[model samples]
Target: MDFEYLLQLILNGLFVGSFYGLVALGYSMVYGIIKLLNFAHGDIYMLGAFSGYTLLTIGAGVIGGQASIAVLVVIMLIAMVLTGTVGLILERVAYRPLRGAPRLSVLITAVGASFALEYGIAVSFGPNPRVYPVRLGNEAFTIFGARLTYAQLAMMLIAVALMIGLDQAVRRTRSGRAMRAISQDPKACLLMGINVDSVITRTFFIGSALAGAAGVMSGAYYGKIDFLMGFIIGLKAFTAAVIGGIGNLRGAVLGAIVLGLLESFGTAWLGSEWRDVFAFGFLILFLTVRPTGLLGERVTERV
Candidate 1:
């Protein structure tokens, strides 16, 4: 095997893994806070991509049909806000009322919400894949014969930055403290004057926003947006969370990177057609073995 080709695959894995990590953060956060699997979370990411598509379409004329990184950033911010609001509203409408209900009921409700979001977009968007307005050029540079696109590099930097910022905020901020406290014990947090429901609402919002930003970034990079696009990535992200130990923020990221590499190597070994098969097979095997995951289920570090 050529060493340069191996390095290229690694780079590709990291790129895709970063996207998985962003979406996985949402899954981990929601699970950490409320122990909800939040099946609808993936559709929130789909919403973000569509929202960015809408904004880009509307603003394209205003910007004279030219899109720059700055323009994409603005669109991404707007999409995040939109998706965050959707998450907050979803929490209020779908999940909050069932707070004390049976876990199975809540899980069913989550599945219902996922279907609602998916078909809602399909009905609105005509079930057709929408092409994004912005498409990054394939301009690239090479290091030791491993190619790196300017767009990939920029997007990776942004993803890493967002991940780091979230980690810092969770560790250092007042809201972060409240989140951790509520995660530990909602009743105790309420006793301590921490608004448990409020923190949870904010958690859903922030987590959804991260997923949204990822959606927009991915849409811009790939140049296509479809209603069902989130389904596979969502599963992969969940696998990543499970692999790294769900509810552990850093663990989710680490798991995503590892999964990415696994997929990359698996694809090379078995071809693209067998890639998903290989990855999902590994997931089943991993769960049957070490269910606690790489970092273990972390209580204090869940956020």
Candidate 2:
């Protein structure tokens, strides 16, 4: 391929990968703390997009014309808060009660929760896709012969900012320390006077909030929202988290970028039809060859 074509592919990969990373962060965080896959997590992203669409639709009636950046930011924050609450409720209702039950039970509950969210939205919103009220304009600028859009740039920057903020929160704060402690040994943390339940709830909140933010950005960029939109993205995010070492935060981001690039290049070589196949194939290969993931440390299980 030519330099410009290659550059465009790279940019596309980065743009899509940023959102994947955001969604993957939620997967990694929840699994790290509770060891639950939380299959419904992607629906939380779908809900977020819907939530942002609702808020913006209301705002459009009041403000009229194109929305200002401040208004869009406000809508995004509202969506994050709304989705985060939904995630908290999901954990409390679906997962927490089964904490001491068999892992298989919890896993099944996760699938059930996913179905509930998907069909619930379908029933409430109808099966038709809704157009996002505000579409971020695809005003393009050329960078080294590769076309770049303002919307894509904005989404990428926002995703990066959120990822960095999450990384800092997990590494720098007292809550971060509590989270780490609980992940290492929940019972020991409780014995040490740490509020394990509260920390876990906070983790869900943060992770879901990130997913929500990604949802809104995606809606704006893509200009359409549907109940089923999260299914593929969710699976892709899970693959990313697994590739990065399921419980590793930074690894999720790295794996997402790598996966995105792979998809971009794969689509260029094969067709778009093979994108999912390519991504899943990599997941299987990674599982077989380096299950610990690129950044994950290998651990020996004790009998």
Candidate 3:
């Protein structure tokens, strides 16, 4: 491939990786606190995208229309809040009661939840895909011979900002300390007067909010949203979290970029149909070589 094509692939990888990373955060956070896969996370992501679309429709007073940046911002924020709230509710209703249940039961419940969410969305929004209006004008500029779009840039910026903020929150804020306490030892956190349940809920809020933001960005960038938009992306994001070291925040981001770049180059070479094959192949290879992941810490479970 030419240098320009390589650059373009790299840019594409970064843009796509950002979205993967955002979704992965939800998986990682849930895993860290609860050790449950929350298989319905993908469905939660789908809900976020649809929520964003709905918000845009209402905000513009039309199905889709050009809106000012401020208006779009409000719509996006509302969508995120609504989606995040839904996530909290999902955890409480679907997962919370099964907290200490068998892993298989939780997994099954997650699968059921996923199907219910997807179908519910379909029934409400119709089975057809909907186009998202370009709140940000569609414009492309070449950087170092690589074509880059404003939507892609905005997606990257939002993803990076959220990632950085999440990192800082975990490392610095009081809530972060509470979260870390819960992740490390929920029983101890409770003994120490920390609200373990509240921390977990907040974690869900942040993670789902990130996913919601990603939904808005994805819809805007791809110019489309559908009931199943989150399935493939959610699965890939799980791969990213596993590859980067599940429960490790930074590892999730790193894994996402690596996976995205690999998929981008793979699509360029092998064809788009083989992208998932390449990603899963990479995941298997990585697991075989380093099951703990690049940045994942070794932990011993006490029986």
Candidate 4:
């Protein structure tokens, strides 16, 4: 009911939603291309955060503890490359061989892969939450009684820019064309001389890269990273993908924004404990009412 508070929540929702969109894009892309859920996608995000954390920690000694803008950018880029490579390998090792297997089998494999990544990191990192060496200090500016941090603005800008870049790539690039073609009919694409496998592999890489970027930004923003942190967020991202229309790039972003706003307002109304309930409730409602989502068409769709 308070207008200023409502505006603040909106800004927060958009910021949160942008990151969700990043992760959800990975889900939607893999699903759209190979029809694999790639539940392990979230774990790749976890790894991204860890990768950045590790790099930053190594640089901490050199940078004297506080990471500058240049250092953070370099670390984020490195983490994205690492995470993208991991996604590429994951597709080859875990999902590619089972490409023709039953949907249930692939689904099970995805879940298994998810578990493997989650606990593997736990084992390696000892399961304790790692404090990110990179920190965006709490400098902020208020707008009409709503406080917005410069860090938040910078992060949101980067996320949105990445999302826009992806949308453009999907729309205007040769690889994007290949991806869409493969998505529609891989068999036909194979017949038409398109390398389906390559396209799908690249999809995973790009999606995972975006997710990795999100993970780094999130770690920097929130100031903590952990192995299992990706699990719930992964589920939420999937919900966003489904809500946005799995194969539709813009839809995924839109869905995430919707989910973020819903959670922001729902938490405002109900409480933090009820946040997940409200978020997932939208998933169920959308599934029952409009399975294809706001932008998904009944006709064959492309990623």
For every model shown, what is its TM-score relative to the native structure? 0.96, 0.97, 0.94, 0.97
Q: Give one digit per residue, the lDDT tens place, for model 3 in 213-287.
A: 888777776778898888888889988998889889999999899889999999999999999999999888877
How do the residues 1-303 of candidate 4 rate in per-residue lDDT, one tens digit apiece? 888999999998998999899999999988888877888888888989999988888878887666766677788899999999999998899899998888889999999999998899999888899999868878899999999998888888888988999999999999999888877888989998888888888999999998999899989989999998888889899999889888888899999999999999999999999999999999999899999998987645333
**How do the residues 1-303 of candidate 1 rate in per-residue lDDT, one tens digit apiece?**
899999999999999899999999999889878988899988999999999999988888886554777888888999999999999999999999999788789999999999999999999998989988878778899989999998899888988998999999999999998887776788889899888988999999999999999999999999999999888888888888888888788988998999989999899988999988977887887688877679865335232
Residue-pair clashes per prediction, in order, are 0, 0, 0, 0
- Worst 10 contiguous positions by lDDT, candidate 4: 294-303
lDDT computed for candidate 3: 0.84
Clashes by residue pair, model 4: none
Cα deviation at 248, candidate 1, in Å, is 0.6
Worst 10 residues of 3 by lDDT: 61-70
Task: Report the lDDT of model 2 for residue 261.
Answer: 95
Model 2 over residues 1-303: C-alpha lDDT tens digits?
799999999998998899999999999899888888899989989999999888888778896656655677788899999999999999999999998788789999999999999999999889999998988776889999999987788778889999999899899999998887777788889999998888999999999999999999888878899999999999999999888988899999999999999999999999999999999999999999999888876743312
TM-score, predicted candidate 2 vs. hidden true structure = 0.97
Model 1 C-alpha lDDT versus the unseen true structure: 0.89
